[model samples]
Target: MYTVSQDCTFTKLRSDSTLRVLFSGSLRLKCKNACCQRWYFTFNGAECTGPLPIESIIYLDQGSPELNSTINIHRTSSVEGLCEGVKSGLVDVAVWVGTCADYPRGDASTGWNSVSRIIIEELPK
Candidate 1:
């Protein structure tokens, strides 16, 4: 189970623009559940239809519990075509965490934790 506590929306991005997705949060696992967790970003809205071309995998263990990561996406001519239908409207960008069986046992809710924040920012040319 995965919960998104915060989501950042963007509307002014152009086909020629490049952007970076910043994700920050923390994770804690009991015992020796240290493992690699994979996460990805998806776009859902009037124009965009599916997951972006970026993905990340982070390792979480008793030694390290904090997560701070970034994924950069460039809107090239080829990829820009995918967003042409978007026109001018807010697009919802989401971050999803991959499932892991080692998640704390108990209620499904206990198996997941909240993502502190997901931010989208345009990069300078």
Candidate 2:
């Protein structure tokens, strides 16, 4: 499963007999100016559920406004961990935080933005 937001793609990967899901994603933020900001984030199936979020790491890239960059958050959290967390029922929700610093260097009016409380269910192991 996947959803598109702000030019960001979030994909859920799974297999039979597995309760874990690998969330692979890429986000792009374009400003009216010539600069660009891109971000990549990933989550384990376990972290995609419940009322509280499972501890996860997010890697971001704010490169040239006109160019595309890739950030692989999965590399920091291996697929194995994702599976374990889901199997243990230790994941609940995922949260994303965005600040004006994430946008263009000079554009400060955007203020703070966030993508929080993303509800995700754990598959039956």
Candidate 3:
């Protein structure tokens, strides 16, 4: 069993299904500063295959939020639009993880030095 959420409360995801979904999202931390990274998700079923590049490490920069400040996965290619609607109080799911990031470290033990995982199922249109 897995717990999922959006910009709000926690919800559960169904684990009995044959299809499985997984993903991650976060903003680049520039110069040890706090940053807010927003990631949109959706279902990219078994048909959704690719050599998708993973942004494992994001570089942070001051006043750089204006530089392509959004992580977007097309609605036509996956179920992102619908899932986003669900996040805004539309549908439901068994497992979901959304909006995560590593903030700048302030105490050397906390903040931007961490990693977050964002997972969501791929649904068809």
Best lDDT goes to which candidate? 1
TM-score of each: 0.45, 0.25, 0.19
- lDDT tens digits by residue: candidate 3, 1-125: 11232222234233222223343333332233443333333232112223231222232333335573433212211122222222222223222322235543211111123444434443433
Error of 3 at 89 (Å): 15
- Distance (Å) between predicted and true CA of 33, model 1? 6.5
lDDT of 3: 0.29
Instruction: Look at candidate 1 and give me any clashing residue pairs.
Output: none
The C-alpha stretches of model 3 lying farther than 4 A from their native spots are 1-13, 18-26, 32-55, 59-119, 122-125
Better of 2 and 3 by TM-score: 2
Question: After best superposition, candidate 3 residue 76: deviation in angstroms?
Answer: 18
The candidate that wins on TM-score is: 1
Each model's total of backbone clashes: 0, 6, 12
The worst-scoring run of ten residues by lDDT in candidate 3 lies at 73-82
RMSD of each: 10.8, 11.7, 12.8
Question: What TM-score quantifies how close candidate 1 is to the native fold?
Answer: 0.45
